[model samples]
Target: MFKYVIQLILGFLTLLMSTAISWYEGSGIIDNPLEWKYSTPFSQIFNIEISSGQDISQLDYFVYAAKFQPFFPTIMTVSVLYICTVLIFFIFQLNRQLAIILSGIISCVFIVMSAIFFNSSTVGGNIFFWITAVGALIFISMGISLWYRKKYMFKFQPQ
Candidate 1:
């Protein structure tokens, strides 16, 4: 439908905007070696030593932004999730049961992600933890509302 297309376009645009902003913000770390320790989680995890900006890959910029300055990266992640959710809802609009199941599964995944970030020491980790927790709640509510509407609000009446 036209509305679905609009929502999809808006979600994609939001994702692009967030990615660009996060990339710009993350690129700052390339100039400031002092921030390297805080920004190079990928390098640390992989045991890769980054002596200069060249040692950092383009993909690492996004990772840096995600760990150190998560606002826009979070937006990017949520936007991608929203686009996927919208597509799933559209695809399963006629199958309420399947939609409900998928919603529950998605919520569970978000819950786990939130828990993973729950004890993070960085500002970005704290923010992502709360965001993912909220996402889980949203998905749970969506499933409940769909189930309620299908079960209680659409009952047939005798003519």
Candidate 2:
């Protein structure tokens, strides 16, 4: 239980940190007034042109920003996966096998998502960095859970 709590806390911290980094970097969402220009393929395809002194903080901006790079999407996906895994562990009471299987699925998905950006011009290498870290964390947590399963079998107690 303590180990699971630590895993959850770590996941939450990573999610928060990644989100903060993305926001700080703007992921090309927030445009500067002095350097407002749109000459990329995304701009041409989406017909997006940011004018100087224009505030752009719409859902479209968020979506387009993600499309611009895999970093944001990868981090967000890992965050959601981490949350879901925690819920499955606590609420569903799934065994270690299921958790490990889910981790494998997540790894496959992460690989595909990261691969999609390999040929993209706008994709940042930071996505690869985060993906590696998230993958390691997921596997490590799963391994720890498996190792301690016999010692700490999680049971739902109605209180």
Highest TM-score: which candidate? 1
Model 2 over residues 9-45: C-alpha lDDT tens digits?
Answer: 8888888887666555554555544323432334435
Residue-level lDDT of model 1, residues 1-159, one tens digit each, is: 788899999999999999999998888778879867766777777888898886776667886787788889999979977986896577556788888888898899999989978998888888888988998998899889878876876577665
The RMSD of every model to the true structure, in order and in angstroms, is 2.7, 7.9
Top of the candidates by lDDT:
1
TM-score of every candidate relative to the true structure: 0.78, 0.46
Per-candidate clashes, comma-separated: 0, 0
C-alpha lDDT (0 to 100) for residue 88 of candidate 2: 50
Candidate 2: C-alpha lDDT: 0.57
